[model samples]
Target: MIEPASYSATEVLRDGRTIEIRALRPQDQQALISALDRSSPQSIFRRFLGARHHFTEQEISYFVNVDFVHHVALVAVADENGKPVVIGGGRYIVIPRTAKAELAFAVVDQYQRQGIGAALMRHLVILAHNAGLEELVADVLASNTAMLKLFENTGLSMSTTRESEIVHVALGLSLPA
Candidate 1:
């Protein structure tokens, strides 16, 4: 009976820095934008799987606003000097009328390889399972080895299919984590 919308936890990065992982709030819109700004073009391309410039108004709203049931999103926040900065985020959106959800994640370029992405994946999987989702899927670029490895290391029953330059991964959630 965990509420995904109000979910929160503290995670330590590989380098031993502590971060707060919590539900993405509407007020986090600006922080998301700031994170995006801090990311390099290569990191953005890896996350979005394509060249992207900016998000439209509707896209920004969709990214920040979640229904908590159908769409669940979480963000990793860390203290930067005196301000809280959004370092990374992950989300799962249920497929209509299906027991599966689509997963996505993005970590700030500087935070890459610090186990932030893994932390986000772990939290998202828990929320998905609590929400009654049977599986989670992700479409990653063929060149994104880190993401593919993250999925593989989850210890869930997983399968992958490749199409063109994309690798689609599916992870069954019923297995014990």
Candidate 2:
């Protein structure tokens, strides 16, 4: 099991830019809020399924504080003009009585398509495996091709079902060989 401590790693993007990935912490509240606020309306809608342009204090607080056992959150930070900025984030909340969890990811508009979301997802997958989770699930909009492709590239055979406007993807955590 991963220790209940902040983990860090460096990932190289498709364009060869590097980013720092670390466990999300309470101190990241402002950075997290800033990234979400600066995201495009369409990006916000794609992530939250609505035009949630503003984040409440309670919501920000809840997202930053993770237990790392049943709840795990990671952030991808990039230095912009010498200051670290939150560009992307990924997290999963465990389902009760099962080795499964619901996963989510969001990357700022300017950072999209740079593999930030995929890197965050990669870290989340490792955290899930170390935590002994068996499956990771996500409910993404059918039109969110970027996110859909990121999930698909996990290399695990995913079972997908479409209902209404939501596409549910289930990936078994056999921990991609």
Candidate 3:
């Protein structure tokens, strides 16, 4: 029963750096496209864990135009000369017939390990909780140790399994008292 309009932008400070966490704005479509376009081949590979280096227009539209009622998209940004640059992003999609959500996140190459991804994930977790979700799940490649560590250190209960060369992780969020 969360109202998307009530969500507000907030800044998180980690390791002496400040990053903005907020819901995606309509004006950010071009910035997101540019960020996706500028992503390195390896970054794309790590995020999607495949040779698919490009995103179709339909894919971009779907990611940006999530149904606000049942899904939420949050982005981490750094402003350069008054224009916001997308450094990281995460989204939560409610699963039908379940109180769990599927979470996905990616940080730009230059911003990795600087707390951008964690900040984005933390914000998205709060959003999911506000929306009454009970858990968050992610599918990550086995080789992506950074993502694994992020989830592990988040203090959530998680289980992992190998699927071919990829790893699937499921995290159950602790309900807020």
Candidate 4:
């Protein structure tokens, strides 16, 4: 497995502002909290699939301390008044003994529709493909049309299953021959 900590890239948003995409670090716990504070409750609900205001100690640890091999994570950092801030993040957790992983992403409310999520998805796809993963899956709320459209725009062969109010999206990582 490659060192996920070594992963970093720069992305240009729709407004022509540059943002850095890098691996999530243990020290980023506070930044994550700040980002969450900047996000709207509706945005949080879509990403988490429910309403949540606080993360437990265990949950924070699990989110920050990634193994890089099975649980890979990346964060989007943008300049905020000359200081870099965590505005968004994406991750994939490989299902053990399988070539499939579940994907998740979150971008602060103010930064939505600025292409941050797409940038994170592009980087994560590269990492997952290099790691020999065959597919990435996400469980998005049916009401989250933006996220559903983002997955659709990935250009990957996708299949979705609707269960109640949730849409399970599976994106094939391998290119067609």
lDDT tens digits by residue: candidate 1, 1-177: 888889999999899999999999999999999999999998899988888999999999999999999999999999999789999999998999999999999999999999999999999988998888999999999899999999999999999999999999999999664
Summarize candidate 3's per-residue lDDT along 1-177 as a digit string, tens digits: 545634556575565656677778767788887777767777788877777766788987888887766778887888767866887788888889998888888777877778877777777777777777778888888888898899998776788888898888888777535
Over the stretch 1-177, how does candidate 4's per-residue lDDT look in tens digits?
A: 556778999999999999999999999999998999999999999999999989999999999999899999999999999999999999999999899999999999989999999999999999999999999999999999999999999999999999999999999999888
TM-score of each: 0.98, 0.95, 0.89, 0.98
Q: In lDDT terms, which candidate is top?
A: 4
- In Å, residue 87's CA in model 2 sits off its true spot by 0.6
Q: Among all windows of ten consecutive residues in candidate 3, which has the lowest summed lDDT? A: 1-10
Residue pairs whose backbone atoms clash in candidate 4: none
Assess the local accuracy of residue 121 in candidate 4 as a C-alpha lDDT between 0 and 100. 97
lDDT of 3 at 15: 53
In model 2, the runs with Cα more than 4 Å from the true position are 175-177
lDDT score for candidate 2 against the true structure: 0.88
Q: Which ten residues in a row have the lowest lDDT in candidate 1?
A: 168-177
Residue pairs whose backbone atoms clash in candidate 1: none
User: Candidates ranked by lDDT, best first?
Assistant: 4, 1, 2, 3
lDDT digits (tens) for residues 65-150 of candidate 2: 88888788888999899988999898999999999999998899998999898888888888888888889999999999888998
RMSD each, Å:
1.1, 1.4, 2.1, 1.0
lDDT of all predictions: 0.94, 0.88, 0.77, 0.95
Q: Candidate 3: where is the Cα deviation over 4 Å?
A: 12-15
